[model samples]
Target: MLLARIIKSIVIIIFSCILLKIIQYLLKKLFEFTKFDTRYEKTLCSVLSSISYYIIFVVSLILILREFNIVDVTTFGTLVTGASIVGLIAGVASQSILKDIFNGFFILFEKQIQVGDFIVINEEFRGSVEEIGIRSTSLRDWDLKRITISNGNITSIRNFSKNKMRVVSHVRVSYEEDPMKVIESLEEVCSIMNDKFDEYLLKNSEGKSISEFKVYGVTDIEKNPVGAQYTITGVVESYRYFSASKEVKLQILIVFKKNDIKIAYPTHINVLHYDNDYKNEL
Candidate 1:
């Protein structure tokens, strides 16, 4: 009887495995058919996959326990009843986990953050969100270090991947250069950028690329030993921001050189008038 029961349990476990696989396959097909595109959809799919595994594991455990006569319906009911009290205490003790879960749900539903988004949390942890679970969110920082933060602990978030990002650049010119001419040159650079890198620029509300680039001329004036600073601001696609900024800066430098615009640089000089007088007296 013991041997037969063992064999039966083995068969049941195998069957459970097959069933779980089938369920997972069906779920995969369903998700594929639904056509998930956004980060939110992908995150939801990951969560659902985890939940389905848990449900299947629990069901299989229950069935296996029943086969071994470890638990009956009456005993299971009693256990569940007793567990409720324990669960209440555990819930109180794990309040942070509960908070994390609540906050995670809010993050998903409200669309505040999502996977693949470059975000900074609490003004300290900056990274691209790799995954968001019920209790914590995973991030990969600029240095490729993995960081995990509890959802409840995320006090602030700065998402850089959403929409177009404003690129603010500064170019310093020597005091001798005409600000008006520099502004014109900068505007020409912006126009050239708009035409040359049109793919990298983003469109405005009117569904046109006309406003994609802007040359806000001479926004800032700084007293530097080298020169005066002029700020140039514009908007571009967030994904290509780094490359776009690099190219823009390079182009600005080239344009300034071509136009004989001298960039500000610090100059130091030393004079020895006393030494010259002593030599003349000698």
Candidate 2:
């Protein structure tokens, strides 16, 4: 009888594994059938897949226990009572953890943020989303530091990965340089960039990347002691923001040099004075 029971438990475990595979397959089909936008769809699929797998595993564990004759009415009742008492103690001791879990579900279902998104939390920490868990969210910053914050503490979110990001380039030139000439040279540079890195420039309504360049001429003119600063702003898809910024700056440097535009640098003037009285004293 013991050998027969052991064989039954093994079969139960095998069946549970097969059921889990079926669940995964169905979930994949469901996600594909109800396709949303790219980023949202990916995030939704990830969270739901994880949650489903966890549920199936828990249910399977109970079935396997039953197959081993380990679960009975008396035992289950005692376990439930013990769990209830423990839960009550835990609830009172860690109210904030419960709040974190609640808020975490809200964040996931409402699609507030997603994995791989570049975000600023409370305008304090800027990082890319690594994982969103029931209790906390993990972020990986540019410096590669992993920051974990409880979901309940997240008051504000600035999601940069959702829409097009503005690329602001500030080019400084000597006050002696003609502002018009500088602006004109920048326009030419933009023209060249539109052709050079066309694929990374912009996206049309159909989500196809296209060449689009805009020169917001001289957004700022700061009269520093050294020189004046000119700010140029343009928009590009968020995915390409970093690469596009670097390319734009390189093009700006090359264009400035080609146009003989003088980039701002500190200059010191030394003066020598000669006087008859000073000569006599010497």
Candidate 3:
């Protein structure tokens, strides 16, 4: 009988694992069919997956215990009482874990952050959120390193994906160049960028897709390079900021080359002095 019970326990464990996979697959398909927003879908999937896993684990544990003749209908009430007492003790002992779980719920309900968001947690850990679990959140940094932080510890989060991002490019040109001419060239570059990257640029209040890019004029004058720094600013979708910034810089370079505008670079002067007294002594 003991051997038979042990075999059944092992079978139950394997079946539970298979059931979990099937549930997860079904959930993914359901979300895909519903056509929910990407962020909402990801967040719901993660939370629901966690809930399903816990439910399966608890049910499986109970079944395994029953198979061992440790728990049955007759002793179930007693088991519940014992579990309650143990739970109280564990809750007090593991307050941090409880805090994490509660904080996780708040995070989900409050919509402070969601999966796939680029965020800085506690103003320290900056990365893309990979998962928001019941007790912890995982982030994948630029280097692809996964960082798991407890929910309770996340004091602050700066979500860069929440709104349009400003793409600012600063171009330094030789002071000899005309400021107005430089501004005109930058404005031309802006117009070209607007035409080419309309989809990436943010829309205006009139529901029209406009680049809203302009030259900020000479922002600073650098003495070392003897150049005037011009600022170009535009708004683009957060996800497209990096690409938009790169394109703007490239376009600036191309336009400057075509216009024969000289980019500023440091020039070093060397002075050589001949010491007549030292030469005579030698």
Candidate 4:
């Protein structure tokens, strides 16, 4: 009976470990096959794996203890007590940690945003999502600094990177030029820029989703220039290039320079000397 019990114990242990591995592997693969974002999928995989592991470990322990002759009311009670203590510690530590995990999980599972999402949180931090972990999310700030934020603190999320990003360039031309001609030329310039930028290499939010680019017209204005410049608001699409918005703006400047279209600028004029005929001093 002793030998039989030992053999049974060995089989149970081996089976438990194998079961854990299989569960983990399968969970990972299931998410991998979905159309969901990789970061969210990966986070989900880890979370499920961790929970499953603990449950399996606890169950295996109970079974192992039962197989031993030492299994009794006192022994079982002791085991339960020990498990509760460990659980309490973990639970306390995991409160904050779990909030983060929940936030991250909801962000992805609920389709709020993904790893490659270009999001602005609290109207302050704007960047591409570099990583989505259980506790915090990592983002590369505008200055290329890595910013890690707790998921629980994410109050407002502006997902501008998920879809197409609009690049608006308000170009002002001299009123001396024909409004129609300049508008047409500006449109053509924008088209050329769009085509050129199509070939310009750009990085994705997650460094995974690579794309060429697309442009669209937002609006235009041939209205009162502060002095003599007509404002033309040309909005274009730089989808998947929010991170490269700066670069897109630079290209617009280059186009303006090459085309000799003066960009809008505010200026104040002061008449130094009175040139107009005026009575000496009344």
Candidate 5:
């Protein structure tokens, strides 16, 4: 009888594994048929898979208990009822886990964040979201370090990948230079950069690229360095923001050098005088 029960338990475990795989496969096919957003589909499938695993585990454990005469359908409920203290302790211990699961579900259903999104959590831990699980979310930071954060602990999130990001570059020029000339030169550089990085830049509703990049001109005057600060701005896809900003700065330097537009810098002068009486004495 013991050997037979052991074999039945093994068979139950194997069957549960097979059932899980089948469910996963069906889920994949269902998502594919619905044509949902790829990220949303992935999140939903993961959460559902987790839930399925938990259900299967509980069902398999109950079956094994019954096979060994340790517990039956009626006795299981009695045991639970008799262990009120133990149940209360377990419930208290699982409060955080329950909170995490609830918050995770809310995050998924509301579409607040998604896998592959670059976000900053709590104004820190900025990274690309790698996974959104039932209890935690994983992120890959700029340094390539993987960070796992509980969903319940995530208070604020700033998602940068959802829309176009603005790229702003500041250029400083000597106060002596004409603001209009500086603007013209910067505008020319903007045009050149727009053409050079056309593929990375975002377009307007009119299907034109002109509004994508522009020179804002003389945004501020720096007294310490005695220079006029010009602002150049452009809109691009979020992923291309860093590269686009770097390229804009490089192009500004090149254009400014070519146009003899001296960048702002602190200047120091020294003067010495000799008196005629001192000269005669010498």
Candidate 6:
């Protein structure tokens, strides 16, 4: 009888393995070849497979007990009671962990954000979505900073790369330059960029620019200075930044350089400081 039960358990285990393999094959054929939009797909599949696998093992346990003629109610009651106590303790102690796990399930279902998405949350951090787990989502910022945010803390989300991103850069120039002239110079720069990117920068495609990215003249800046020496103080806000490549920044740099305008740098100038101080002291 023991040998017969062993054979039965082995056969059940083999059948369960075959069933799981079939399910896996069907799921693969169902979803198209899309890269890991979510880590939970095959991972969840494996979790399910493990659960099913355990069910088979449990059946084997019952069969083996019956074969040994020791399938008694008292033994079953002892096992169930111990399992219940352990489960109760785990449920109480792991509420937060369970919450994260449930939230992670919703995240996967709703597709809040996926890997390789650019998102900003709470002004605390912004970067590419590296990994989204049940507990936390990992991000790698532009500066190569890795941050993990819990699913609970992620209330507000700003996904910039969902469709297209507007790369905005602001340029502040002296109020002396004509707003029209600056715009015109920028338009010329835009013209050049349009031609250079015609092959790659795509929008309407009829010799048109990639996208209508242009310079909006001076916004606002405080005229007041340290000692009121600098008269023309203002800021220009430029919008429509859509270059996936790093060429946009370079183009802006060249635009400023060609226009004889330079990015601001911090410097302190003292006029005859030593002589004046010495003379005053004397």
Instruction: Give the candidate number with the greatest TM-score.
Output: 3
Q: Give stretches of model 5 more than 4 Å off.
A: 1-22, 60-71, 76-86, 173-178, 204-206, 222-228, 262-282
Candidate 4 lands at a TM-score of 0.53
Q: Estimate candidate 4's alpha-carbon lDDT, on a 0 to 1 scale.
A: 0.63
What are the TM-scores, per candidate, against the unseen true structure? 0.74, 0.68, 0.79, 0.53, 0.74, 0.58
Per-residue lDDT over 1-282 for candidate 5, one digit per residue giving the tens place of the 0 to 100 score: 899999999999999999999998998899988877887787778778878888898789768877876556677674564355446766886899888989988988888888788899999889988888888899999999999999889999898876588888987888899888899999988898788789778766776763478987678874446788899898887778778888998888898889889988777888978999999999
Sequence-dependent TM-score of model 3 = 0.79
Q: In angstroms, what RMSD does candidate 1 have relative to the true structure?
A: 5.0
lDDT by residue for model 1 (1-282), tens:
788778887887798788878876776677776756666666776566656666776676656666666545468684575456547766786788789879888987888887788888999999988877777888999899999999899888998888778777888888788888888888877877788888787786775764466667665455566777776766778787777889889988999989989888778799756677799898
Tens digits of per-residue lDDT for model 4, 1-282: 888888888998999999999998898778867997675676566556657877888787667766774343356676676667657867887888788778877876776766666788878888877766556777887789998888888888987744444444444555555666555555665565446555333446664324332333323444555424322222323353443456556655776677666655667888767644654652
Candidate no. 6 TM-score: 0.58
Each candidate: what lDDT? Answer: 0.77, 0.77, 0.86, 0.63, 0.84, 0.58
CA RMSD (A), model 2: 6.3
TM-score of 5: 0.74
Clashing pairs in 2: none
**Model 3 over residues 80-144: C-alpha lDDT tens digits?**
85567557767786789788889999999899888899999999999999988898999999999
Candidate 1, which ten residues in sequence have the lowest lDDT sum?
Answer: 78-87
Instruction: Kindly give the stretch of ten consecutive residues in candidate 2 with the minimal lDDT sum.
Output: 65-74
Give the worst 10-residue stretch by lDDT in candidate 3: 69-78
Stretch of 10 with least lDDT, candidate 5: 78-87
Give residue 262's error in model 5 in angstroms: 4.6
